[model samples]
Target: MNTLNNHENTNILDLPNEMLFAIMNKLSKINVLYSLVDVNRQFDQLIIDSFYIHDLDLTRKSLSGDISPIDKQTLDRIICGKILPRINDKVNKLTVEPLSIERIFHAVDYAQLYSLSLVNFSQEILLRHIIDNAVIHRLMTEQITCLNIQVSDKIRSDFSVKNHSNILSLILFIRENLNDLTFSHWFIGLGLTFFMYKLSSTSCVSSTLTKLSIFVNTFDDCLFLLDRRLESLSTLIINIVQIFDTSANIDNTKLPQLKCFSLASYQRTCSYDSRIVPLLRRMPNIEELTLFLSVIRMESTYIDGIHLHDEILIHVPRLDKLLFSITTILYNINAKIELPSNDDIQRGFIEKEIYQADSYVINDPSK
Candidate 1:
């Protein structure tokens, strides 16, 4: 054991600089490398020369917080001189928080690249500045190929209008670039008429988008916003939460190329709305279906007796794999059922029979 330990230690010490650099890249966290930089001058030089600093994580390091002017200048120099050039070709993903659009634009301009994501960005001026400015226009025209915009409904009412215009301009930009796009946090009560209008009006859209995911706060919003046809999309994932009242029917004829579909709902009450049945029946090639009901309050007689059984299981016949997860909490009114286990519902009635027949045919056809 002592000889093996000594040999391993010697090998680590004798490892080539290139091998050490590769190992450092695989550490998976920046803090580990930071620690190694403190160990020896050789390692410090390795870290600095590798230009790993090109991936600036301003949010993670809290560099946006108030700082001394000298420190800020020094950081800016490091980013502009050492980081930006290395990132010119290699960096593709950029995430910006809602704090300040000016900071985001400044960073993006310095980076001279696109494929950006704005998370919970509620400020209108920042968005307007991007759309109105020439520098951003050039950047979007040349470099941007993927865009993600996230809006939170908890902000002030005015934020919604700002978000709407920003989305309109963003959609227009994507229509021009034909980029892969994702829209998160599609809350209810936000006027989506403008979006719908633009989507319907686009004549020769050349979007390279192959995947689209939308998260809606209510089923009504999902039905409304998702009612349009996306001719080029090949994969779609929809997540709805806390509200299941829908009158609009899904139009699947618009999405003929869809090969993957995922539907998930959590902490919400559900019912057997007749509109959803036809929608499920229309998705003829769906390979997987997952149903998750969590922290559901069972009060409405519409959901309790026969609706859940009929609406959830009896529909969606094309699903090759079905998964169900349910969670409920007891209250003073009645003893509520706990969350269902991983094995609660083995298979729906038809699924079980199909599985048995397939198993018998595969194992013993003569029998």
Candidate 2:
């Protein structure tokens, strides 16, 4: 019996550090590292040496208020010591939940990390901590690459002018970073000042951005901002809450590098500003275009003076594919209309021979 037990212990010790590291990486929570530290001296050393502890989720559950004091202390030590020291170089993704700006700043300041995701954050939280924190601003300049800022309607309802200024400051800071940015929010009540401020701030670093998405409540605000001359931008996605015409002052020639564009709008009050067709006229390099209309009325005009079909033929001559999602109109003044099938648009465009014969595939195969 003694000989058999000795052989089993020897086998366990023979396991390679790589295998041990893999096992630790599979843990769902970083705190689990503490548990493994107590398993054996070998595990403790292995966990300390592994660098794959880069994905961090700081939701409330992860930082449970019920955590024992000792555990909290231990976590603080690990974060301030090992984690923070390697933060700027090792961490690639980070998700933070709704918390005080102070706590958020504390986590971000020490991390000096990139790829930040903010969830359930309001304008107040952003203004208080992130905008006010100089250290956070400095860290963003050096390390951040991907950023996601999402705000709900309720949050917008509570936004004030001061809050708008705070947001502008944050945008200015981000523009300096010139990273991939995603802004998801309803800018319904916010005045034109917000758009002007944002555009002026972002224009400073438009040359560095590769991906940009704006979810706006009104196309008017977006069009006003897009009117400014952009230096560099490759991918663009716009989800508008209301239909509005693009500004005539827009300099389309500046968007020569654009490769992808998507516009989604609702149909009930759906109306396309004729300026869009002309704007599309300038994006000759766009390979993929998706236009989605939510509602349709029976009497609604199918072809406005914009000549969407004609513009596509002239400007985007090398277009690969066009996607159209439109609702059916049951009646215009009581006249019934059938919804056009998506495939119908595809077939119609193909029959017209509008797409380039050897253009790049619309749907990325690798994705």
Candidate 3:
């Protein structure tokens, strides 16, 4: 019996590095680091590998179905006391929430850190801990190359103008060494959704930024972000809350460097011809385009493949990929207008030699 038990029992250290790494990949980085670090000389050397320490997510992991409760005391003790100090230099990317942000940054100065993700931080905490703090500001401006910001606060009923200015200031502040950015703030509750952001006229004029994804309040706001000052911007993705004609005519500079563009808006626009078509024409050399738009047609029929081909595709000679989800809401004001069937939409696609197409038409008399 003793001999049989000895044969069945195998030490984890006996596993090869490849096998150990595969096993460690299954657990959260925190769990892996906490459970494995300081076990012995071999485990310490193994856990120090860049694969284990490169991207450290310090935020609390989602606890949907775990049987054991997270021991915050133990986690704080292990991470702050043991793990971060040893692996700080190897960390290239770090993600943190409000609770752990100060503690994590205070433990050590990550010399090789280039990317940072701030999640679920309130405006107050963000301003006090990160934005206004001198050390964090220097780290962001001098070292960070990629940044992602997601605010947790909901829009107040009496949303103050100071709050708007603070947001704009925050965006302007984090503009020195960044190459990629994704900034979004939205809250969905009580059968309502809010995503309100408008770029200021004096936005960042960076030559190094290559990709940007942001949420804007209006189509004009979207146009504001596509400033000629962003000389090296090659990819732009925007989710607009509303789409409409601008009140004033702005600069219509050709974006030759913009190789890819994606625009999504849930609200409907009646002026697709005047506003949206002209906007697409600005990107004369675009290679890839994606649009998710709702059109409220007042006098015209649905915007089909032919309209896209003539209006958008004809302008961009290099466009090799196109993906769109367009919905046209038709309303009869004076007379019953004839609307195209799904077959008609498909025929248009076939005529354009666009084989990959999915079209649907829904008629709602209530609207």
Candidate 4:
């Protein structure tokens, strides 16, 4: 009787605004908007506030990397209903699965949206977005600054060499307006060679592009962008593998604005440093650099019996921060990364943003 009376006496609406926002932050914003929007006048007004409705995730994903879209009934109700109209203007980032992306875009216009995260889209849909479509024209109205594409397993499995070439062409098309680009979970297929060929042949570039993170067929594929003279590029995280049979040579390309760079090797190679030193030499303005290798034997002598740090600093004159990491490739196709602590940290480098499990400390870029 006392508990029931206490609950009745202290209503949730009586809480302070800050306390209410703090409680709501723990729950999904999507669920919050669905549940509390029509509760009362005060609730409706609060849901549309900039603090609660800036970034909207229209779909949810599981830990094992599966995208679970919202149910169609609820989705249709939300779209035909008053929710989107109420807060559409406040949305800055919209993350949506492909199934509902078209409908969501047509439902309402986001005046302030700048970031679009496209998840699990098929090759056909990806191509559609690139062509002369309503989505492209509508999207161009806003100054799009970022594009995050997560390729679905089905798409990767079905994409042939020609299909993947189309995907690369789409990337080049959309990259003109994008400042930051990120792609997740790429499947290695023979088709990538043709895609790389297209990228290397193209001179089309983005002056606004500043950051890029992608997986490529070979080190030459990664260097294709640098050779094109992407002048505004500042940060890059590339998964690179050097194919021994392929002709890999560093051009006279220079990234004058590049400040941070990270490299991930997909295969085990005995000559990691020998191949990498020339690549670093091209980035004259790099202040922070990270190298992720599949295997590293530190006890062995480096080139010309020189210390690795001295050789790297000699090549990249502006490099003051670096992360040197090694990862183990397992039989199950899973990777186990172990960052050894021997030289870079012993010389007084500190750990910055960790990529995988264990990470090597790096020199400070601010210095």
**Top TM-score model:** 3
Cα TM-score per model: 0.61, 0.64, 0.82, 0.76
TM-score of 3: 0.82
Looking at model 3, residue 300 earns an lDDT score of: 71
RMSD of 3: 4.2
Candidate 1 overall lDDT versus native? 0.49
Q: Which sections of candidate 2 miss by over 4 Å?
A: 1-52, 60-88, 98-112, 152-162, 173-175, 186-207, 244-254, 266-269, 273-276, 295-314, 321-324, 328-367
- How many pairs collide in each candidate, listed in order? 1, 3, 0, 0
If the candidates were sorted by their lDDT against the true structure, best first, what order would they fall in? 3, 4, 2, 1
Instruction: Name the runs in model 1 displaced over 4 angstroms.
Output: 1-58, 61-74, 97-114, 152-154, 158-162, 172-175, 185-208, 246-254, 272-277, 294-367
Clashing pairs in 2: 267-295, 330-336, 331-335
TM-score of 4: 0.76
Model 1 per-residue lDDT tens digits across residues 239-349:
765445445444555334555666677644534244444555555566665555543334322122133346544544456665544443322245433432223333333
**Cα lDDT of model 2 by residue, 1-367, tens digit:** 9999988778654878778666656664455544554477776556544265566554434335321122355446654444445443455676655543344346535453678766655567665546566865665667677777765334243245446545644664565655577766444455222343244444433446677787655655555445433446677788766664444454555456778888887635434435455567777788888777644334443431133566464677666767655443323454444434445544555666544322111222242
Name the candidate, 1 or 2, with the larger TM-score value.
2
lDDT (tens digit, per residue) of candidate 3 on 129-180: 6567776788887898888877656554435334544654565467565788
Give the lDDT of residue 53 in candidate 3: 74
At residue 293, candidate 4 shows an lDDT of 75
Which ten residues in a row are the worst by lDDT in model 4?
348-357
Decide which is better by lDDT, 2 or 3.
Answer: 3
Per-model lDDT: 0.49, 0.55, 0.76, 0.65
